[model samples]
Each structure stands twice: as structure tokens, then as C-alpha cells.
Target chain A: MTTSPNSYADKAAEVAARATPERLVVRVRALSDRAIAWLFIAPTIVLLLAINIFPLFWAIYLSFTNFRANRPNAEVKHVGLDNYTRVLNDPDIWVSMQTTAHFVFWTILLQTLIGFALAYLIDRKFRGHAFWTTLILIPMMLSPAVVGNFWRFLYEPQIGLFAYAVSFLTGIPTSEIQMLGSVNLAPWAIIIVDTWMWTPYVMLICLAGLRSIPDYIYEAAEVDRASNWRQFWSITVPMALPFIMLAVLFRGIENFKMFDMVNLLTGGGPGSTTEVASITLKRDAFEAWATGRSSAFAIVLFVAVFGLANIYVKALNRVKQR
Target chain B: MADVTLKGMTKSFGKGGAKRAVDGIDLHIADGEFVVLLGPTGAGKTTTLRLIAGIETPDAGTVSIGGRPMAGLAPASRDVAFVFQQYSLYPHLTVYENLAFPLRSPARRMDAATIDARVREVAKMVRIDHKLESRSTRLSGGEMQRVAIGRALVRRPSIYLMDEPLSSLDAKLRGELRLELKRIQKDLGATLLYVTHDQIEAMTMADRIGILAEGRLVQIGTPREIYADPANLHVAARLGQPHINLLPAGLLPGVEMPPGTKTIGARTEHIAIAREEGGNARIDWIEHLGDQNHLHIKLGEQKLVTLADPDMAVAPGDPISLSLKNPLYFGRDGQRLV
Candidate 1:
């Protein structure tokens, strides 16, 4: 049988001519734009509500009750403010808080100074600078677990490169330098490892800030007869302050809840000398299985970080505005 | 104030030093004079300013400020204030602090009261005193440039070097700032070397205009001398509105013939035209510029544009006789033939 080429379109046209406006409206194939947009986005919203928002509210609810993960079949009671008061009054928690504060303070201070210095040197565009930059970034590129394990090996008193080097420098025995084993040096040992692993990240951010400055400003400063020292304080430091602050913000939040590296390296070692807040939270939640009290402690931490970060961000904005 | 001098200064850039950014150039600017180097982009106008400011080390020769040879001297020690093409103000500082920065150098060791006084004086001069406390990044383009110029003015250096400081502003603001800069220069009697490609800027503000091309100094003179008696075809093309027109040596009918004359340069003053039935040139178009009109005429295959009054009896396609009256002549080598 022979078929005409326009037969299909002709039949469709005949159906369209016979249809009424109401029938045409009923035959519409696609939903409105708003409905289509929601259709595409619904899965992501539902998943986020289930995984993120639900857990957050659930944790808040658990913080007010006496619930134990190990004793789930036992009676659960809504013991209002009891878990919060017990966590707050615990002396062990206070010790962990002080250790965390010390670690954060020293690590931030050392990383900023060393990172800025390295960034300044790299900004000079010296020979082999690209090679050096890549070499310096190797530590930051590795997984934190790898870095922690590696540094832990280096901290060993026997047959370790770091202990031997320190011994050689100070003319002392390698066995005397027990970094992770001794109470006095355990906190410092963690600080040193964290600085080594993360200083490159801070340097990268500062390098970006340095490169963003146009060359003409320096030329202008030179023509204005500004001394090199003056230019460093007046032009270089002030211009890079905002980026430095941003790096601090990121590192601050990350280190507040820092866990993997510290756990692998020291594990709150040498009689709780290096136990940070996150280690305390992990012990309470997983080891002792105190779900309700641990959840209360986690809420307190979240508020502290959120509150401090908000204040820091406001200061950063003020600096940028200048 | 000091007399600035460049003795056979030369500079080159690129790998293996192949591209000559500034060729051998000898120039002198007497004390309290305003000299402008006019050239198109890549003509080495900015390089010359940088060389004088000691920002770039020349491959040969020397730059002298106040008869002191400046070789191996740092830019900061050279004592020449430079205004960059872009307003390179310190973004983290207020306008007042930016102006006070040059005074705060350890070498200067200026007292706080004196620094404050100078900053306020310059802020008022540039007409940006109202926004002294605002950050330099917060101002508009023109206001930023004003602050930059004011920063340079706060220092009393040997000479001032500006690299197209007004080129970034709009036409209206450029005109206003040009007048203000000239007035400020005259008032201070500062020895200044300003570089730009704008002919109007050079003509109106320069005590002497230097024409540069292909990294070479082609000619240097007062605006009128450069216009009336250009040394070469390049210098003649550097100045004047509607530009000097070039025609075949015998294309027009008014000048006495000189031997080896390959081309004739004609401005509006040299060209004379009259309406005739069978004239040599035909009016191609008339561009009305309000105060004056640009009359584009066709002489066989060659086209020339000249300024004309708006009320002139001419229109597109009108036949008119065109001839030269004491027009400039150039040899085959592009050198001027007197």
C-alpha cells in the first residue's frame, strides 16, 4: 500500500479543528513552570530535610532527655537540663577545653606567621618558585590520616628522623626526646604536626591575596619615595589582611572539631595532656555510649563555634570595607 | 625644582632583548617647564617616563635630574613623583591616609602636624576634601584619579612624571581635569613630563610637545612650531584635529614645485576651496560637530577631511575646486622638504 507523506500531519490537523477550547486545555501535556521547577528540586530538598535538618532537631531533642545508646530498650526519660548541667560541671570537660584552647592558639599563631612568610617569599617570583610551591603543597594534598600516621612514626624516639635531628641539634641523646610519650611535649607534638600539615593551605590563600595586588601600586609607592620597609607595613600587610582573616576563619572552624589527625597521632595521650574537645565528645558518645549527655556537649560546641565565627566574620567584613 | 635631562637613553625588552621599547633618545626639560611626549600606543612614551623615574633600568646612557646622573639609583631615591595611568591608590587606606603616606616614609620623617597640613592642602586643591575620610576604593573613577594626582602633588620632588593620568576618565571629566592640571602646574612652577596620545591635551597644555614613533623621538617643539613646521610625515600626523592630510605632490594646484617632493601635507589653513561647475574635488560628506563641521572631500582616489564652519556653503556631492597654499612637502624618505 502506498502512503502519502502529509497523511499523519493531515490527520492531526483534522483532530485539532474538531477539538473545542476546553478539550484543548484538558489535553495540555506539561505542567506550569513553577510545578516543573519544584519537580526537579523536590528530591534534593527531601533528602536534606531527612539527613541534615531532621538529625539536627533530633540531636537537640535528645540533649534534653536521658537516653543511652547501649540501653535503647530501657526506659527513656525527659530529664530537663540534667545532661547539660552535668556536662558543664564536669572537671574533665574543662581540662579538655583548656587543651583545645591551647592547641588552637599556638597552631593558628605559628601557621599564620610561617604561612605569610612563605607566601611573601613566593610572591617575589624567584627562579624555581613554581617547583618550590608544588613541593610545599605536598603535605596539604595528602589525607589527614596519612599525615597523622606518618608524623607519628617520625615522633618515635628510636630510629626516627625528627628525634635524631633534634638530638643532633641540641647535642642530646635521641632516646631523651619522647614527643608523644611525655606529658609536657604531647600537646606541642600535636601542634607541630597540625602546623606542618596545614600551613601550606594558609600559604595558598595568602598567595592569592598577594597576587591580586596590581604592580602599579608598588611602582606608585616607589615613586612616592616610600621606603621598602614602609611599603611592607603600609601596602603589603594591610592589603593581605582580609585573606589572612578568611584563612584563619576556615582553619578555626576545622580545628575546633579536629579529630582524625589528633586521634591517630596522640589519642589524648600521656595522661590526657593532649585531649581536645572533639576527643572528649567521641569518648562520651561512642566509648561510654552516653548519647544524651554527648548530644548536649555537641550542642554546646556548635553554639560556641557558630557564635565566635559570626563575630569573626563581622570583623573580617569591617577590615575588607577599609 | 630641577632641570631634567636624558642623555642617549635606550632600553629593550623580551627574551634575548629583541624588542626595543625605547631607542636612543636625548631630551632636556628646563626647570619649571611642562613637556608632553605624544605618541600612539607602543611608541615608548611610557617607557621614557619610567626610565626618567628610575623604574626601568636603561640598556645604555643615563638619566639626570638637576645635573645628577641617575644610574643604579633606586626609584625611591630618585625623588620623582609619578602618577600612573590607572589610579593605583592604596585600597586599604582612606584618601587622607593615601595622601599622607609619602610623607610618612622613614627618610622623610615628617612631623604629624606638617603631614596633616600637606594632606589637607592637596585634598582641597584636587577638590576631594569632602570625602577625605572615605576609603580610596569607594570613590568614583574621576575622584580616584584626583586623589592619585593629589598624592603625587603632596611631595615636592625634582620633577613630576605622569603616564596618561586622564586617559581613563570620560571626555567631559578629562577636559575639566586637563584645565585643572595645567593651572596647578603653572601655580607650582613644577617641572613635569606628561605623556599622552591625545593631540588636544598636548596642544593645550604642553610648553613643548615631543612626537615619538617606533621607539624613536621624531621631533620636539612648541605646539605651533610642531604644527606649522613638522620635521617628518610622522610628526605632522601626531597633532591637529581631523589630522593633516597627505596627497600626491602634484595633486593640488597652489604651491611651487620643489625637487624630490613625493607628498604634500595639508591642514585646513593650507587648503583653499571654491564652488565651481567642473571642480577637481567632490564633497563626499559633511559631519556636523556643532561648533565646527568636518568636510570630507574626494580628490580622484584620495580622500581628505578638513574642518569647516557649519554655515559654509557646501553639502555632500557638491563640486568644488581644491588647491594647496604653502602646504608642507615631504621627500620620498618621509622627511620634510622645505
Candidate 2:
């Protein structure tokens, strides 16, 4: 019953011992809202810096130098803007740029047209629509590497199904029409495979857009004495324009950096006929071991994609506003 | 403008649950008449409107416009225009484009100048001409509805079908547009088959109102006729603001009613109320609504309402005498007895 410091200290020691360190910490302390949030997100921030931001800054720094990864003992000279100028002035890089532009334009056009047509057909709620929709989406689900390998085999001149079918239809020999070997046909082959794989992706987005249009709008159109074609152009297209544009933007960004399918099918062979920008960057960085030059090429590509996407996004916003 | 006739039209939707949305109902709306289909929610008024517009095919019966059967005809071929309840304005188009959409359709290819001229005329008719260049989302609800009406009117089809066009507006806006719509219908002299759940709209706009209950048209008459005499207890109960007082004829021991009558109906305005000491009812409350007063009165374990003139002074707990004028009588089946 005596109130003494010794007794009080003993009581405090007893209480502290009864609550173990884990229990004490859990029950006695509370972090502030911001501290808790930061604690939860710290790992993500650290990982993002290590994997994404650090490499970006590193590449920007490396683009200004003449450092080759293969030649370690060579002096890392600070050649200001030399890599940028060299990459820009090189005619080979322009060829790749042209290839990329051609690929992006054709692939987008084919995918959008075919994709929107498929979407319109599926929107009819025809017999077995759900089953057909799932089946049509199979192409988009296959891995690009697998698709490329199979398509390359199909393009084989002698024993391939595609060449034989063409030969059978046109009365030409299968050996004479080589899809992968010929320079002119190699580009078409890659474009065809890309359109085949990605058209379903575009169609999926368009299907969602088409489905989202309310039934009442069409009914109103009907009551207004509009023909079916008129309704299609006036109501359906305008309503689904935003979603279609969104799909285009996504496909454009993806196809601009396209590498795997073309690489697997042609390996940028047939005398550099189908070498896209990403393919050239890959060859320079990993094969030639010219890290600084490859980094500059990659920067140019990144800026191009970023700028084009920004422009497309502005158009998308305007469509949505309308 | 043309007459719209529906002969025993019926539509039943059985997808999730079997419900007859519109039973066999016959109606003949004459040329240049504004007829409103009045009912509660889910009473198949909209379905009937859709059937008349050829948007829905009747399971049994046929709709004829201008003496021609609408069987196997598309909505476009039926020569009708429809306005929806939600003001389904095309959100992506300007008001001018929305008004011009119907006119510029390939079927109705009036050249650009004529289309533009008609758009201007209808826009002015709806009083939305000034806001024609604005995007639909930027306009207010009333303006959107006006544009919707303008869209329906641009082509001047043979008949007009409107589905609860004023239900989305606020009360004040609905009143203003209701008046505007009445004026437009008169000026155009166009046949319109309008549908609404609001009785005030039915009373104010329709030259004749048709009452629907459980997918059947029970009665059709002028507004004054429907007001003075509803077809049955259901129509009587649905048509008034405070609601018609429906009483069992045999329950009121002192009130005199026709023999063999099972139900009695009286609107608030038709009921006679007087302040008396020896009274049969006690006032529970008085609600002042500007120029009108609503009296909540208790009568023999039943609560009834009576509308009082604003000048009438009364309060809760006051004794009052209640009488019925032109009391409605119904047999046990709820059909009106003349």
C-alpha cells in the first residue's frame, strides 16, 4: 500500500513483461494516416525506381556517350549529341522508320476495318453468337511467338498448307510462291499475321462499344423514319467512335514497337526488307553491342510513340466530347 | 395528320417472368386529336404506344394508321414519330443536328436548305432555337426535352407517339412544357398518342384520356368526363392528387347510397365539408398549398382527405360534417354503376 518509486517501477516492469514486445507494439502504437500509407507503398516505389525509372535515366545518360558494351577497355568518350546525329543521319535507320510507318498504317487499317465489321456482325445477336464470339477471339489469345512460328511453317514453299492452297487456287506451283523467302512477300506475310492476331483485340473493344449503345436510340431512329443504313451511319457509328478510336490508339502504340512476330518469322532477313525500328534497335544493342547508339535509337522511337499517342489521345477526347 | 386505330392489340413478354404487358385493347384516335394513355407504372401504356408506332408487334390484333393496316410494316414505313420519356437526345450531336437528323434521313432527303429551314422552324416552335448550336449535355433538362420534341416534329410524320415525355422534368418545368406541348399540338393539328403515369399531365394536355389498368383499357373519355366519372374504382383512385376517397358503401351507417352498391367513391373537391359540433369526423391536420388547403380528417376508424378553399379556416381536432356529391357506386367486381 506504500506509494514508493521502487514499488511503482516494479509494477511497471510487471505490466511490461505481461505484454510481450510484439503485443506491446501492436496494441500501444498507431501510425499516422500518411505514415501507414507510405509504409504500405514503399516497396512498390522502390521496385518502380529500380526497374523503370533508373533504367530510363541511365539510358538518357548513356545516349550521349560513345560507350560500347562489347569493348569494355575502350575509353567512354563524351561525344555530345554525336549518337543522336549519327542515328538520325544513317539511311538504314530511315529505312527501318519507313518500315515501321508502313507496318503501323496497314496493320491499323486492316484491323480496324475487319474488326469493326466483325463487331457489327456479332451485334446482330444471331444464332450461336456467344459461341462464335469466343471462337473468333481465339487468335488474340494465342502467344505471338507461337503464332509466328506456326505461320512461318504455313508459309513454307513446299509442304505448307497456305502455299499449296494458293497454288491450288491459282494453278501455280507451291515451290515458286515463297511467302517468307521473297522480300516483297515477307512484309505482306508479317502484316497478315499481325492483322490476324490483333484484329480480334480490336473487335473486342468495338464489340463493347457497340453493345453499350442503348436500345432506345435505335428505337427512336426507327420512329423517326430513318432507314437502316442511315441509322448505321448516323447513330451507331457516332456512338461507337470513341471506343473505336481508343482501340486504334492502343493498337498503334503496340504495333509501333512490334518485334517478336517479325523477328520469329523473318529475323529481319530477306536482306533487311522487314526490319522495323525495334528490330534494328535490338540488333544494335544486343548483337552489335553498341549500347550508346542503340539507346539513342530507342529514345527516338520512344519520343515518336509518345508524341503520336498524345495526338491520338487528343482526338479520342474530342470524339468523346462530341 | 392521320387517325390511329388499334384493334384488340396485345403483347406479352415471357423472357424472365410471364407478364401480359398489353392485353387486347381497341382504340380509335381520330385525326388531329391529342389522346393520352393514363395508367400507373407497369400498366402497359408504353407498350401500347410502341405497338402503335410499329416498334412492337402485337401478339394478337393489328394497328392501322390512316385506315391502312400496320401489319408487317417497319416503323419507318408506318410514318410515325416518337419521343421517349428520358429525352433520349443524341449526346454527341448539337441540338441543330439532332433536330435535323430525321429530316436528313435518306428516306426524307429534303435538300440542305429546306432541311435547315424546317429545323429552324421546329426549333423556334419548341423555343429552343437559341440553344441549337449547343451540345446536348450542356443544355438543361427542359431544353433537352424541347429538342427531343423538336426532333420528333421535324419530319411531320402521319402520327406522333410520345412515351411519358415530361416525366423527367421538375414539377415547374413539366408544367411549362406541358403548356407548350399543348400549344404545339394545337398549332400543328397533328394526331398524337401520348402516354404518361401522371394524372395532372393527362388532365391538362389530352383532349381525351384513356385509363389502363393491368394491361387493359377500362375507360376512355374527355378530361372533364373522366374527372366527373371514372370508369371504375381503380381509375377513380388513380386520378386525383390527394387521391379519391374509396369507402365501403355498407360501412358508413348514416350515409345514404344506392341499394346493392358495394363501393362508394368521392374526390376531395366533390366532398362537402362543414364545421359542426355534432360531426361525424375530426380534422387531423391542415396543409396550406398556396391557394388550396388539404384537410386530413378521421372518419369512423378511416382516414379521408378533403380539399378546402384557402379562405376556409379550420384546424386539427375540429369537428366537421362530411357529405358526398355525385357519389360513385360499384358492384362487388369494381365496375362502375351508372
Candidate 3:
């Protein structure tokens, strides 16, 4: 049968009319959504480029030049890795590196152990858990400089409470003892003070991680008839590993470039025994006016920290994915 | 398998009687029997399970496994396996390791070969053998749940305590796992104390169901007994689908029904409806379900829902005859009149 032309044309028109408005609206909506998304993201991108990327490139460029702050108007000489060679070969630089490693390792280990214990104790949810947590967090909230000064006073041999307490407890003669004046005791002193100040920070993070775990897990562990030690090892520790690593990373980076606490407490004293890399870098750039060498040293320190932090972040991501 | 008995189990939160989470509860679960605890939220089903698992100690009770008092005994000393609702598999461990954990636990003290064999066997039973190497966090919800079941199964404890293990899964998965759980329980022949708020799960899975409200066991019976003869209005309302029709008998005028049947409850399918104008009722609406239709009828200010065949033609305002079959009657105090 042959169809009428007008009827066929009318059917085609009907189909076209039904499809046009919805399609146009959808296209307009999609374009507007894209525009709105870009509008929201533009400021963040610009700020990141200005504050983070540009400065990183500037620092990289500055590392290769013999640029001294005192001789600002002088021509910036291209040193061609001379500063890096000097930093890598210097015995004092190696000493500082060793000191930094010692400080980071001891402080992070002590802080993690102490912090996890405190978090576990407080996670039991007693009558005054909130109050205790707030009290524990006070040291972390205080300025590092203030804590350094306070601990410096406390470490004084004659008038310090710690010295008197130690002498009373151990019957060690305190008359000739000087805590911050000795090479052997100074690094440990700095580590102790740093632990006292920052262990609570680690504890708070650990507490959050611990509390985030559902009680059902512990219940399941119990049902499986896991002993207390087993529960602590398998359930509590593994679940809180990410937080522990996070605490390690924070304390590691902080101790690597530790300046304020060391400067106030020991001033890198006892013949540079307590002088870490950051302190050495500071003395070179500001005190000794070896700005080029110090910049190179700072760059080395930056690369080490960046590499370590990248590895830690990858571990943290893997833990989170699990 | 061993029988579990809770004698005057009472657990309180905070000192000086701040809150009592579980009040004095006395229950006996026989060996190789499946008992389902039904309760509303905060009714202490989970607390009771924890107490039985030795995760929490009762303030004033003796929990016994096989007639031996578990007082002061650690959880490890009490031979009971617990399955949690959230599928508490170690996220860092693989499905194999997760199942092998309890098997290798020092308290359980299975040898390496035995642990390996048990893990393999339970994994096969749960049908998660293929995904044994996969990290538990990567598994789908159903797979993770199966792995959790396998983990519990590997222990071969005397008693099995599950706290709403299938609550988090979707409906289809829940139905499938319910059957699996029942089959596994039967095969293991373990004394299983399961807790769930879903009445259907309790009905389908339990040899006997214990209903709890406000930390007290209100009623305990088999599935047929719970459905056919509910102890109270709460049990009646909570235990049925197309929910049991509740109609006030006093409102029906000139109807000489049973004098003790003040409030009548009947399953929707049990109520009969017809187009004959014998009763004083009018159809309000008709919901055409695929296999059957639900006829919503109004009778003297009460709504009566009736299930009929889909082909039955009924419209709003159509006169209909109504009669309740095997209706349950409740007294004025809300207790069943049975």
C-alpha cells in the first residue's frame, strides 16, 4: 500500500518535534556544568601554582648558583656542583647527618611507643576520658619555642627540678652535673624534651585511629578466643599501623629540620655534638655567611626529606586502601 | 557441641547503676540447637552475645559452656566462635589468612598442617576458595561475608554465636546466605545462638526463636508457633509480612464476634474478600501485585487488607464480603487471648 506524502511528512515532523527540546536542553546543561566546574577549580589551581610550584622551581635554580644574601648586588656565579661536592665531603656535614639520623630515629621510636600506650589507656572510655585527652594534648598545642625554653630551664643542673629529682631518685651527685653542657647527655636531652612535647600529638592521631575501629572487631577477636596479647598484636596494632606511620613521618620530618627546640635547649652545644644538619645549615647560611654552601646543604636535606616522605605517603596510601 | 546457659546474666554500664544495658536474663541453649534472639534496637541482643563470647563480663551472672561455669574465664578459655554483623575480617589480611587466624591462634592451638587443612576445607565450604588469595578489602560484600563465615567456621568451636551477620547485605544476598548459614549450621551440628531483628531471618533459620524487648525475653518458640500463636501484640505485629491486620472489634456494630476478642489480628492472606454485598464494607483501593492483589477495604472506620487473586476484579466503592480465618484475638491489656 502506498502512503500519502502529507501523512509521512506529518509523522517525521512529530518525531523531530519530540526529540529537539530535550536534546537542546541536555547539551546546554552539559556545557553549563563544565563551565561551572572550571569556575570552581580555577582559584585552587592558581594558588597552588603560585605558592607551591613557583617557589620549588626558584629554589632548584638557586641551588646551582653562588648566591649569598650579604652580596645581593654581586653577579650570581654558576658554581657547577661545587657546593654539592663540598657538602657531601665535609666531615662536619657527615657528623650532622649522623646526629640528625640519631635524633629522628630515637625521638620517633620513643614517641610512637609512648603515644600508643597513652592512646590505648585512654581509649578505654572511662569517666574522664575527654578531660584526660584534652590535658594530654596541651603540650602539642604549645609553641615549640616555648617548650624548648621551658625544658632548657628544667634541664639546668643547679636550679632545675629534674636534676634535683634525678639526684634524689638515683642518689647521683647533682653538684657537678650539667645536662645541656655535656655532649653525651645533650642529644638525649633534646630527644627527651621533643618526645615529651610531641608524643601527645602522636597519641591524638593514634587515638582517632583506634576509636575509628568498630567495637565489633574486638568482639570478633574475643569470639575467636584471641588472648589479650593476640588482640593487641593482630587487631589493635595492624589496624593502627597507618596512624603509627603517619606519626613517624611527622616526627621524622620535624626532627630532621629541628631548629627551634635545639637552639633554645642546647644551642647545638658540647662541641657540635648535638648539632643536627638543620642547625649546621643555619650556622653556615646565617652565622658563617657561607650562603651558597648552606643553600646546597638545604637542597640536600630537602631531597632526602622529599624522598622519605614520598615513600611514607605511598605506604600510608597502601594501608588506607587495605 | 555444648549447651550454653546464662544464669541471671546482668550487665550494667557505668558505676552506681547509671544504665543497665542487659538486665537479669536466664536462658538455656541446648546442644546442637539453633536459637534466634529477636529484639528491637538497643534491646541488648548484641550485649548478650558479647557476654556469651566473654567479651563482656556480667555484673551478676554465671555463664556456663557445657555446664561448667565460665566465671572469670577469658574469652579464649571459652570455646565459642562469634560472627559479627559488620564482617570483621582483617582488612590487611587475605581471605586465606583471615580464615587461618583463628585456626592458628595459640588458644585454639591447632597444628600448622591441621590449620592449613581446616582453612582449605572451610574456604571450600563457604565457596570462597577461588578468592582465597584476594585481599579481603577488595572482595565484594557477598564475598567478604562468605569469607567471614569461613573464618568463623575454621575455628570449629563448641558454640557458634552470630550477631546479625547478614544484616549489611542486600536482600537477595541475605536470602541466599540465610540458606547457606542454615545448611552450614546443620552440617556442623554446633550450638548456634543467632541474633537478628529481621523476623523473617529468625523464622526461616531458627529451630526456636527468642523474642526480646527492653532486655527481657518476651517469648520463645518455633517458627510455626511464633507465626500461628504470637504471645503479644508486639510479637504479632513484628512477625508477619503484609503485616497482620489489626482491627478493633468494638467498632464493628451488630457483629456478635467472640466477647474476648477485643482486638482481632489476622494475616493478610488469611482474610477473605468477595464482591457479594453480605458485609457492611466498601473497597477503598486495590493494589495489583503480580501474583496476587491486595484489596484495601474499610469496615466501620477500620482498614482491612485482604489478599486475592490478580484476576479478581474489584474497584473502590465496591461492596464486598469479609471474614477472618483463624484470627488471633487480643485482650484489652494487649496480651493475646489464646
Best by DockQ: 1
lDDT by residue for model 2 (B136-211), tens? 9899988999999999988788888899998999999999999999999999999999999999999999999999
For model 1, the local distance difference test gives 0.93
- Where does model 2 sit among the CAPRI classes? medium
Report how far off residue A306 is in candidate 3 (Å).
1.3
Q: Which ten residues in a row have the lowest lDDT in candidate 1 chain A?
A: A23-32
| Ranking according to TM-score, highest score first | 1, 2, 3
Q: Candidate 3 docking category? A: medium
Give candidate 2 regions above 4 Å deviation. A1-37, B15-17, B310-313
Clashing pairs in 3: none
Estimated TM-score for each candidate: 0.94, 0.92, 0.88
Task: Record all residue pairs in model 2 with backbone atoms less than 3 Å apart, i.e. clashing.
Answer: A322-B92
DockQ scores of the candidates:
0.69, 0.61, 0.63
Q: Give one digit per residue, the lDDT tens place, for model 3 in B66-119.
A: 989899987778888888888799888899899998877775557889888888
Candidate 1 lDDT at B330 equals: 95
Fnat per model, in the order given?
A: 0.91, 0.84, 0.84
Chain B TM-scores, listed for every candidate in order, come to: 0.98, 0.96, 0.94
State the weakest 10-residue window (summed lDDT) of model 3 chain A: A25-34
lDDT tens digits, residue span A188-228, model 3: 99999999999999999899889988887887777776778
